[model samples]
Target: MKRIAIIGAGASGLTAACYASGDGRHVLLFEKQKKIGRKLLVTGNGRCNISNRNIIAGHYHGHNSRFVDAVFSRFSLQDTITFFEELGVPFIEEDEGRLYPASLQASTITKVFQYELKKRNVDLQLHRRIERIEYEETGFTLYTAGAEEHRVDSVILAAGSCAFPPAGASNIGYDLARSLGHRVYEPWPVILPVTIPLKSLHQLQGIKWDAAIRVEVNGKEQERSVGELLFTAYGISGPVSLNVSRSVNAAVIAGKSPVVIIDLYPSMSGDDLARRLDRLWSDGGKKTGFSLLGIMKERMPEVLCGIAGVDPEKRVASLTPADKEKIAGTMKNLILEPGKPRGFQEAVAAAGGVDVDEIDPATMESKLVRNLYITGELLDVDGDSGGYNLQFAWSTGAIAGMAQ
Candidate 1:
């Protein structure tokens, strides 16, 4: 039997091992951490969003994002669902087609993989980190910490990116790829909160509102996201903020300022919002400007009124047409300049990795090295939030595993 070594034991590593084993091949899965799937266990806030039903190449980003098409064509989303189902982990769909295990626990997926791996008698070496790899014409020799070496016929580098360091995320995968003559794009954190650092917004910390967020760099619109917007002491968070953070971070990294324009009422047009404010003011018998805008959360009206140059304590009936227009405009377009995105410690995924042009997407094997496969976030491709990243991981891992 040929000995195949798989590194990282993460979402991709585990999936690859499960697929690559038991075909007259002995798979050795190595993990740096004491336990397997540490990062996987914390995904989706511990729910383990396995994949998204709405898988599309457009949802992914990279220098050559089209590379994902070949991989996904080989192992589609339906194949992922069926593979998990056969492993006794049926999925349940949530909002946005986010698929989770029926148990709704990340531990369930890990445990099921553990059971299957054991049944297949694959060698799972936890706490064994492969420090370096030496490839020869005969085969490959892997060097772990303390210079312990093992020989294998094929190697799979499924070690993930440095997104969540607490879960053993590191740059080892990138380092390994580079040593093997692959070009690695500088990695940056994505899917994290942005730090606006505006004192006016800080006062509204802990407030959660469903709004639309648009990221603009140098007066040009870049990207937009619509969902829950959360206020934090440092800046903005929540799904909407996280979704657009990639663009914000990219602008900041390029030394350009990124402004986050929020639409408090995305469902309403400017005219609609102006009309609603008119009705509220007209109906206010003796309420202050603050009290008239009771549709907003507490303390929010004061901020909006302050921005509009209207006194919160002033009677709504006394507000002029100009004052109402300013208020309406402020409500429709709340501009905030964000500083930098939170670091990798808080990011859900990273933005860059080994350049996709160096890998064969159909097989996920490195073009520079034969029988060497790369998978998961280690590749340059990263997907939008809402289970897209995990879907890419599953597709790439499955393709790499099944590759001869």
Candidate 2:
């Protein structure tokens, strides 16, 4: 039997081990952490979003983002669903095609994987970190942290990126790839909250509104998203901020300031909002400006009125057309200048990794080194929030495992 060594034991590593085992092959799965699937357990706030129904190349981003097309073509979304179902994990679809295990517990997926790996007789070595790998024409020799050596016929590097450090995320995967002559891009934290220094906005912390957001870098529109907008004491979060976080973080890394423009009432046009405000004012009978602005959250009206230079205590009937216009405009185009993104400790995924150009997208095998595969967030490709990243992980891991 040929010995195949796989590193990381993460979402991709676990998937690869299951597929690579059997057929006269012995798979050795190594993880530096004490437990397996630490990162997977915390995904989707512990619910574990396994994949997305809408898995497309467009949802992913990287220098060679189109590379995902070839990988997905080999292992499509249906294949992922079927693979998990076969392992006894049925899925439930949530909003935006996000798929989660019916149990709604991340531990369910990890436990099933553990059971399956044990049944397959795959060697799962937890708390054993592969410090370095030495490849030769004969095969490959892996060096563990204790200087123990293990020789294998093939190697798969499924070590994930440094996204959430608390979940055993590290740069060891990049180091191993670089050791083997692969170009590793400096990783940046994406899919996290962005910090804005506006004190007025910070006062509105804990307020969430359904809004539309557009991110601009150097006055050029980068990305747009529509969803819940959350105000944090530090800045903004929620789906709207997370969707555009990649663009905002990239700009900060490039030494340029990024702006996030929010539309509080995305479904309403500026003219429509103005008309609504007119109606509200006309119906006001001895009501204060703050009372008439009851369309939003309790404390939001005062902050917005302050920003628009309108007195919240002023009588609605005393308000001029100019005051109404200013408030309407402020709501329509609420500009926020973002500071820096929260670090990888808070990020759901990372943007950069081993350059995809060095890997075969179809097989996920390294073009520079034969029989060596790289998969998961360790690669350059990263997807948008809402289960896209995990979908990519499943596809790439399945492809690499099935590759000869």
Candidate 3:
């Protein structure tokens, strides 16, 4: 039987090992971490968002998204659900098509992969970091950091991208791809917090609420996301911010200015908000500005009053129509200047990696090297903050696993 060597026991590496081993091939899965799935365990805050119900094309970003479409078509979101179910792991669908294990534990997903690997007779190696990878006429030889050598008929570089070092993420994937004559784009942080200079944001620290945000590059709106926004001491985090961070990073990489405009009241238009303020003034006579807008957090009214140039000490009934309009506009549009993306340690994933132009989308094999396959974040493809990234891992891994 031909031997297959898969580097990195991540979600993609684990999936590739299962498929390649099941095909009557001897599979060796190597991991640098002490245990498998260190990153996976922390995914979705330990709940493990396995996949998403809506795994469409628009959710993914890359130089050539057609590659993702082709790979995902082969193994879809439903296929992923069914595959997990067959492993005796049930799941539940949460908001925005996010899927979590029924046990609400990420360890469950890792355990299922472990059981499958054991049953398939795949050899699992841990704490073995490949230091040198050399391709020969026959096959490939991988030398680990400990000076151990491994030879296999095929090599699948699923080592993942360098984003979260604490989780054992490394740059080995980029090194290996470049060694094999493939172009790799500089990696950038994605799905991470955005640093802002607004000192007022400090007042809203630890506050969590829903909002709609649009990313603007050089005064041009690039993308928008809507979800819960969490204010932090450094900047903003949460679903909406994380979703649009990729665009912000791209703008920065291109030397362009990126800013985020947030709609605090996404559900209400400017006119509706103004009408609501007018009604509040009529209902609550002789109330301070802060007291009139006390429906939200007390700090929020003060911040809004400052942004709209309204006096917190002024009575709501004493406000003119123009003051009400200004307040309404401030609530509808909160502009913020963004700094650089959070460091790789805080990023959920990286935006750029092995260029897809040198990769075959149908088979996921490196076009520049024979029997050299690539998968997961090692590729340029990145998805939104939901379960899309994990789904991409599974799909690409499966295709490479079944490669002839």
Candidate 4:
């Protein structure tokens, strides 16, 4: 049996260890932390979204898409469910195709795998962080933080990206990949909130409104997502913001300033809204701008007034055409200029890693390194929230495991 060393012990690496062991390979899984699955426990807010009902290539963003496609071609969604079932983790799907464990606890899923691996006699090494990987003529030698080394027939770098550094996430995989002669794509903070510099905007922080945000790179529509937009102390956070974060990060990575346009009232046309406001002013017993009912939620009148540079005490009868137009424009589209996003500590996941083109997708094995494989967030692939990213992890993990 070939000796296999799997790094990281997160979802991908542990899954790889299990799969490699199932193939009668002597599998050794190493983790830097005292325990495995720190990141996994945080997924789905501790419920652990295991996979998705709709496993489509469109859901994934990568430097190489075809590689993931090929892996799914071999072991798809059904295979993932079956693998989890065999491990005794029952799962159910919420709305929007997000699948979670029936027990609804990430700890449960992690426990199941830990139990299964022990039952199967897999060597799991926690607190043994790998320092370096040496590709020798016959096999690979892995030096650890504890000053010991393990020689293995192949090394699977399921080592994740640098998102949760506290959880022991690092760029060790990228380091290993480049050291062994593979092109590395630049890593960026993704699935993160955009930080705006204006305190006026920051005052509205924590306010949430349904907004359609469009990210532009040099006047080009790079990304768009429409949903609840959250105002933050530093900038914006929310579903729409997180979804478009990839485009923003990508532009920044390409050395361009990322710009975002927000439509606070995307569903309602600005002209119609203005006309309605004008009508309300004339008919509502001559109500003041600040006291105008139904213009928005009660708490928002003051903010809108500030944005339009209007007196809150001004009566609707006294509101000029210029005033109405400015209000309409502000409500329609608010321009938010952002600085760099919060680092990996605040990110859901890092953006880039091992280039998939350097590996065979069907097996996830390195094209240059014999028997070496790649999987999970370690590969340069990310997905939108709503559990898509966790699903990618489980799907990629299952595929890599099955391949071994």
Candidate 5:
């Protein structure tokens, strides 16, 4: 019987093991951590967003789109649902097509994958950190840092990227790929909180609102996201902040500093906001300038007043047209100079990995090394903060599992 070796036991690694072990191949899955799915357990804040209801090629970002396009064409979002359903794992869809397990537990997803691997008779070896990978005419050989070694007919590299190192996310995949004569794009942090230049901004910590955020690099607007914006002592966070983190990290990686712009009132135009303030002043002439925008958190109005150069203690009736416009402009565009990303420790994912061009998109097999398959975050592709990244893992993993 032909033997197969799969590195890592995360989402894609486990999925690949489940499929590749089905035909009774001597499958062995190696995990660097003490147990499998440590990172999976923390996905979706432990609710385990399994997949997205609507997944498309546009949701993914990488050096090449053809790779994701080809893989999705084979194993689609529907196929992912069917596969999980067959494993007795049901799903529920929320706003924006985010799919969570019916039980709302990320552990459920890991349990089901573990059950499937056990049912398939897969040999799951934990705490086996692969130190090196060598290819030969017959197949491949793997050496663990502990001095244990194994030879197999085919090898699957699903070791994942080094994003959350504390949670056991490692870069063995890239190291192995590079050792085997494949190019690796330097990996950087993504989907993480960003640091801002406003040291006094910590005064607004714990304040959150629905706002529109735009990231500009080198004076050019790159991407914009509209969702909840969170203020912290470090900088900003929340769905909107995380959504645009990839573009921010990409810009910084390219040696450009990014400026983050927040629109506190996304639903209102500047003129409309100014008019609203005018009405507020008309009705509450004796009120302080800070009290005019009291519809938000008590701390926010004062902060905005300070940022807009308006005296918080001044009476609203004493405000001039320029003062109202200034307030409106600051409310519409709360610009901040951003520093580096929070790094891999706080990152939800990494932005770079083994170059996609070195692998066959359809099969996920290394073009430079035969019988070597790569999948998951180990590849250059990464998606937005939602379930898109998990879908990429499933799609590429399923294709690589069935490769001959």
Candidate 6:
């Protein structure tokens, strides 16, 4: 049997091990962490959202997205469900296509991968930090920080990106790709919190609410997502912010100024909101501005009052027609300036990895070197929040393992 070396036993590396070993090939996996899946343990805050019921490779960003499309077509969402079900990990899909194991435990997801590795008798090495790889005429030699060397017939670079540094993410894979005559794309942070302007910081702190937010750059709509909006000491966070961040980054890198519009009431249209506000004002003419907004977003009536251009001291009967129009506009369009994003150290995942041009997307094999394949975040493809990132890892790993 041919021998294969897989580095970094995160979601991708371990999946590759399970697949390559299943082919009756000797698979050796090296994990830098003391235990594998440290990052997976914190994914979905430990719920371990494996893969979404909706898997769209178009959501992924890369120099050549066609490569991602081809790979995902092979190991699609249905394949992921069937594969996990075969391992006794039944999944339940939440709203918006997010999928989690029925047990709702990340440990369960990791355990199944570990079980597969054990069943295949794949060599799983923990606390093993790979230092470098020297490509030979026939194979490659791996040097590790452990003062050891191993020669293997094929190598799959599955080391993830620099996100979740606490999870033992390292740069060994990037260095290997660069050193081995491949063009590595400069990695950027994605799926991160958006830094707020001073006005937003002063006006909106310690605020938490569910709202639909859309990011626009240079008058072009970039991304739109609706979820809980969390106000931090520094900026805005939560699912909406994180989901829109990729577009924000894409624009910022392209030299476009970014803006965010928060639809505090996505369910209500301008005309509908105007009618509702008029009804409320007619019913509560004697109430104060703060007292009138209790009908909508009870969590922050005072803030909503400011957004609606209602004077705090003014009674509802004192409002003008123009005031109602202002209220409707502001309710639908609460403008915010989204400044630079936080670094990759805080992102859910990073964009830009080993250049897709340097690797054959079909087999994920390095185009510049023999018996070398690449997978996981080390590749240039990243997806939207919903479990699409993990699915990319799985599909790419499967393709790499099959080629090996």
> TM-score of predicted model 2?
0.96
lDDT scores of the candidates, listed in order: 0.88, 0.89, 0.87, 0.78, 0.86, 0.81
Candidates in order, TM-scores: namely 0.96, 0.96, 0.95, 0.91, 0.96, 0.93
| Residue pairs in clash, model 1 | none
Residue by residue across 1-404, what tens digits does model 4's lDDT show?
87888888888887776776765677788888888889989877678877778788887888777766787777777877888888888779886678898999999988988897797778989888888888977999999977798988888888888887867778887887788887777887888888878666777777888889998877888888888888888888987888888888777767898788888778888777777766667654454555555756654666666766876677777777787777677677776667776799878888778888887777788898877777788788887777766666666666666666
Residue 403 displacement in candidate 3 (angstroms): 1.8
**For model 1, what is the error of residue 53's alpha carbon versus the real structure, in angstroms, after optimal superposition?**
1.6
Clash pairs, candidate 6, are none
Candidate 5 wrong stretches, greater than 4 Å = 283-290
User: What digit string (tens of lDDT, one per residue) describes model 5 on residues 1-404?
Assistant: 88999998988888888789866589999998888899899989889878888788887888998888888888898888898899998889987889998999999988888888888999999999999988898988889998988999999899988998878987778888899998888888888887886866767899989999999977799999998888998989988999998888777777887889999999998878877776677754565555665567867777777888888787877877788777888889988888876889988888889889888878889888889999999999988888888899988888888884
| Regions more than 4 Å wrong, model 4 | 279-289, 292-299
lDDT of 2: 0.89
Clashes of each: 0, 0, 0, 0, 0, 0
lDDT of 1 by residue, 1-404 (tens): 89999998888888899889886899999999998999889888899988888998988899996788888889999999999989989999998788999999999988998898899888999999899998898889999996899999999999999998999999999999998889999999998889987777888899999999998887899999899899998889998898899999999999998899999999999998877877777755555555554689987988777866788787877877887787888888988888857899989999999999989988899999989999999989889888899888888888888884
Among these predictions, the greatest lDDT belongs to 2
lDDT of 6 at 281: 74
Cα shift from native, residue 261, model 4 (Å): 2.3
lDDT of 2 by residue, 249-361 (tens): 88888999889899999999988988888777775554444665458888888888888888877788787889888888889888888986789999999989999999998
